[model samples]
Target chain A: MSETAAPLAAPLFDRVAIVGVGLIGSSLARALTHYGVARQVVCADRSPEHCAKAMELGIVERATTDLAEALEGADLVVLATPVGAFAEVGEQLGPLLRPGMIVTDVGSVKQAVLRDVGPHIPDGVHLIPGHPVAGTEHSGPEAGFATLFQGRWCIVTPPPGANEGAVDKVVTMWRRIGSTVELMDANHHDRVLAITSHLPHLIAYTIVGTASDLEDDTKSEVIKFSAGGFRDFTRIAASDPVMWRDVFLNNREAVLEILQRFTEDLTALQRAIRWGEGEQLQDHFTKTRAIRRGIIDAKQA
Target chain B: MSETAAPLAAPLFDRVAIVGVGLIGSSLARALTHYGVARQVVCADRSPEHCAKAMELGIVERATTDLAEALEGADLVVLATPVGAFAEVGEQLGPLLRPGMIVTDVGSVKQAVLRDVGPHIPDGVHLIPGHPVAGTEHSGPEAGFATLFQGRWCIVTPPPGANEGAVDKVVTMWRRIGSTVELMDANHHDRVLAITSHLPHLIAYTIVGTASDLEDDTKSEVIKFSAGGFRDFTRIAASDPVMWRDVFLNNREAVLEILQRFTEDLTALQRAIRWGEGEQLQDHFTKTRAIRRGIIDAKQA
Candidate 1:
């Protein structure tokens, strides 16, 4: 069924407040307005420059540095700031929230959303934590495009006993904005992303750091010859540092668990290379090829 | 200076033989013909199916499994096979080679080319190891395209006292095919590529394998939500397994050295994440971002 089959006259949310105008937040605002899901979009960002850029881009009807002003008269409030700032933002937002308002988020780590922001939610408010599994290495309001979420997955991990109507509304909004929505447990979401997202970013950052520390002559050569494979890691490593810092800190246990497995796997391959075990290296390399094919077949590649 | 400004009317070689009708070989063959660089192109492959595909695609004038037959009347012979097979292939071709023929290769590792194939070169024959730093995740002759090397670097590592005339001819041929050529020491080339290319591939293969070995239910979710960062690694891991297997095996010392540094760096980041040291994580991530900017400014991004 088409989630956007609603008539053109209908606006899913009369007033939607986006409480961070960075890449994900700006992109969400653009998508919501482009899909006619929100009659009015207001964004709050700590950076005055980002707020002004969002306004100039016309992604929202209003932009401000005041979190309370942005939340005024908004039935849907999205906490799109970095996860590290969620607890403080939650404290400031609690007094501004009204009964029946729905609160959601775009943090990478899901469980942290509940731990940081859940207590501040009003008794009658609905809390549904979400993660839009899509982005480029680029960040900021200008880096965001309206089509960033197209054909991507948006995972929603609503807290237990979340109002069904609020969850359905959020799902419909995401679907209308061109994401396939998946409902998952918060802890399970963290585990899966630890492998799929967090671990990969960690590896990319490490390798890029290694390259940067090379002798000056060798460093230039690395950049010139990077098209071989290093360039891909550089792009991943270019992702927003503050956001990733928060992700690693908030999802420490899962990320560390996966990192340990990755380190062990890497050590075995290292040993294979050290011992001239061509068959072992080839066998492991060959097995990984099938996973790539699976991802391509799933339209995720 | 503009490399391709040379008039297209001049053919760089009378006849060229490309050993191994795979992605790199076929693309070089197509570029030779597309730019009128070779009067005739011949290809040799162990796979009859690939030979047939090369012939049907018109990328080569002749295709055969017999290396000697393919090299007949060819002034330029390019060994484009996996590095592990070079010693045997070199032994076979050494008897068939005539004096003054320029033998170049597109191997990822340079020192290995000299070690495995150096002794096989006949007196007066030129052996210049060339690595064109470009490729997609795809492989095989059908995956080859004429524009693969355009604007990419082709590093040529020639042995001491190599014939200057032969080196100039090979450099001119690569230029005609739209590559910026750089001359470097073979040992240095291996070390640079070890960090820029080999280590990244090793890391990618390990991470992809880690994700693949997860519990089946979580594995599917990892693939489904991979756009976050893992998808990029999967693309790199999807690269030809046999080709990469030989790379790690042939360039063992350099690859291991770089891998050691990478492991230490990763462990540092892992510790920071485990201890919730957001500043340390943020600082390292912030430093890596500069390398990406350098790649972009260099037009390699």
Candidate 2:
């Protein structure tokens, strides 16, 4: 047992398969290989162009369109695809997984992953869902870098009674790639992310869309003057449409709940503006400033 | 006359008084002194600490809490105070201004600046309301830098039939300090900024405020996991509370108009999310991506 543990402590996986080669997937591929955590990194992307780019970028040792082909001899399979496709992908991936293999995902919404991918895990295969709370507005294979996950938080949501070794291995990989790992319940992950990620993206998308529909002259001016704050929203709104759509759809309950709270707060502020209630407006704005200080103190700003 | 023309083409003002010595005010003071556009930069701020800091920082040659004292011997008076304070400041400075003195402002809301400061302008004084569409989230006198206005757009809205020489001097000063000056109507400036600046700030303040009110455990987690999106909002919402509160109050009509549109659009998106309209959300998200590309192409990103 000690002899077997020696190699297990070395490279975590001999062959690792990333099932999607987008921003997060490509970043992981580069990081795993750069850290020597995976001996061989393979990519399976539905987009042939992404697969080609992944290979050309040298982030993956091999690229394939077939999930089964990518899974062959792989000890770890990472579902990096959109959350909406997770259930279907899990259905296809269950039959191909080996008993000792581990299946992990990089979805933003965690609860949906448990509901969608939990049933498909084979009797002996371990499943751990995670979200690395980091991203730029850019997407696609070429947009990723090896250091993308550095200093970021990666939350791992492991189902009850799951293999302890499997959970530790996944956590070790994230930490090796320079992420601070946190073990959280899937439900709590979804709720927290709804406020932090999902609601912000939704608001960004809404505001940008509203600005885009302005008169042609006004639209041009909006772009010209965007440094005023709208520019930041535009960058957030520019994130991958399909990915964000899946995030909102998959985490509807938490997102909608938080969003309802947001709408009420916004309405109160709006009324304050209409009534020229300077005190009310100033009070709210003052309270929000403390949060930014907290974020700076926490070293997240 | 030729000898006078030589220096006339040199420093624009013999004594420039900057009221309110805050971020924009202090930055302009630095720029004016750095570019030798003003012979002496004097500051008048309600906050004695800011006045002392402005003088200590060497952005101003002298600082005073007395507006009349600072404006003495000043040929140019820049109202750098919040719009909410503009009317009161203007009323006090109106009788003290000498003939040929130019009165300009760096207010966010142009129409309100004109409405408040216009009536107080003496016959020889020029009231050219301007908004330099640039700033960082930081505030106060020390936060100002010489290059704050570099490559940014400055919209100058001179009331109809205003003094051409006054307008030209203000425009030339901005251009010398590296701003691209554009002549726009005060109404148009207010409307455009409502979408680009005011609404975005309001939304950011609301979202960050919402997150700040979360349960202590979740609030800490939100900060820890902020790289997802909430961090951007926090930065914007961290802006000076009094300045933003005044902006919303002064430009209530225009801000309310754009905000009404934004709310309706947000509601539509919210309904889409409720019904799981993935395609609709995706389409809106994709369209907004084009706006970011437009901003990049415009070199405003």
Candidate 3:
């Protein structure tokens, strides 16, 4: 991630296994090896092609389609698949988990991870859910790199009364990969991300969809002149459809609540424009600039 | 500008005057000098501070508060003020324009430029309205650079029965300054840009405005976790308020029309999410990805 990270003195885990070796999963695998955070990093993916690509790219020491084989002797198991696959994957992964093993995930919606995978986790195995707020529009194993988590925030949501040691290890691993770690409740994390991540994506998808439905001539011009602003939305809308679908389906309540608020604000602005209320529009835009300034000061800009 | 552009054989215009030296205006001034497209670049601004800043930055050869002073004997006059000021500027500019002088503008909405500035142009003066599909969120003279329009499209909307020689000169100047020129009707240009530029800015401003209205605790979290997606909207929403305000006010019809379509599509997607229609969401998201590819292929991404 950051060029200034100090070299790791020792591996944090003896054996680490990542499921669904796509963008985030493969990036984690690369980061673990690149930073020497794991003695051995392996991955299991539903797509054999991704497993082959991960190994071919030397991102992981071992790659396989079989969940049990990949999880064998893994002290740390990361479920990096889409949230929709968690229940089925969790059912198969439960018996494979050994006592003292720590299981975590990097899904967008954290509460769903708890609802889908929490019950399937055996009593002795730790199930700590985490979401790293970092990724590109690209997906699949080849799209990942070692520094994807560098300078990014990783929110780890450990269940109530969970093992402190297990939570600490997960936090430490993220830190070793150059991420700042924050711990929050699963419900709160979902609410925050619905506004910060999910709603932006949904709006982007909707706008891009609107453009695509325009008359052919206008649609082509939209693509031609997209450098103005629409191109940014296109990039966001280009993100993995399956992953985003699961994000919307799983985090319905929070996303919809925030989306309603967004709609109300939009309608107010639309009214301002219709009525030629320049002062109101300018004031709203002016205040938002302060938030951008705050974000820059926070180093998130 | 692309590294492949050939050195200019000679200056395209002598004594170029740019009114309202803000972000796009200052950049154009810089580009005219950097590419040796103008023999001398001068700017006029209502704000004395901006005029001084432009001179301090060496973006213009001469900067003045009086539009007439800046346009003195200039062969080319570029109206670079916000569209909202075009009518007032045009009223003042009408008598000062010399015969055979080519007048153009760099506004976001084309029809508004024609409506506001068109009638004031006298006989023998060419009125060509243009919109450069480029810019950053930054504003003011200091925020501009010579390459802002490089590899971007410049839509030139010349009225019927306009002088061909004047049109060619305007198009040539844009090409010399590192832009691809496309000629179209003013009405069509407004509609194209309504979807491509104005609508995106409106949505971004709306969403960032929504985030700004959140409670303090959640607001801080929005900034903290902004990297997920909201950060991009913040960046877009950080654009100059007055300029964007003018954009929405002038381009109301097209912007509102496209906005209605966007809201309708969003409602459909919202319903699909509420109903747990994963297939519909995935299919819609998947199709939008193709438009991103189209942008990338157009070399506009």
TM-score attained by chain A of model 2 = 0.96
How do the residues B1-301 of candidate 3 rate in per-residue lDDT, one tens digit apiece? 2232548357878889999998999999999899888889999999999999998898898999998899997999999898899999999999999899999999998888888898999989999888888899999999999999888889999989889988888888888888999999999998998898888899999889888888999999999999999999999999999999999999899888998998999999999999999999999999999999999998877
Candidate 3 docks with a DockQ of: 0.83
Angstrom error of the Cα, residue A60, model 3: value is 3.0
Evaluated against the true structure, the overall lDDT of model 2 is 0.91
Per-prediction TM-score, chain B alone? 0.96, 0.96, 0.96
lDDT of 1 at B247: 96
Q: Each model's DockQ?
A: 0.82, 0.85, 0.83
lDDT of 1 by residue, B1-301 (tens): 1124455367888999999989999999998888888889999999999999999998899999999899999999999999999999999999999998999999999999999999899898899889998888889999999889889899998899889999999888888888999999999999999999999999999999999889999998888888888988899998898999999999999999999999889889999998889999999999999999999998898
Candidate 3 per-residue lDDT, tens place, A149-246, comes to 99999999999999999999999999988899999999999999999999999999999999999999999999998988899999999999999999
For model 1, the docking class works out as: high
Which lDDT tens digits does candidate 2 get at residues A1-301?
A: 1222133447888999999999999999999888778899999998899999998999999999999999999999999999999999999998998899999999999988888988998888999888898888989999999989988899999988879999988998898888889999999999999998999999999999999999999999999989899999999999999999999999999999999999999999999999989999999999998999999999988
**Residue ranges of candidate 2 with Cα displaced over 4 Å:** A1-9, B1-9
Give per-residue lDDT, candidate 2, residue B71.
92
DockQ of 2: 0.85
lDDT of 1: 0.91
Tens digits of per-residue lDDT, candidate 2, B63-166, equal: 99998899999988999988899989989988998888898999999988878888888787778778898888889999999889989999999989988998
- The positional error of residue A85 in candidate 1, measured at the CA in angstroms, is 0.7
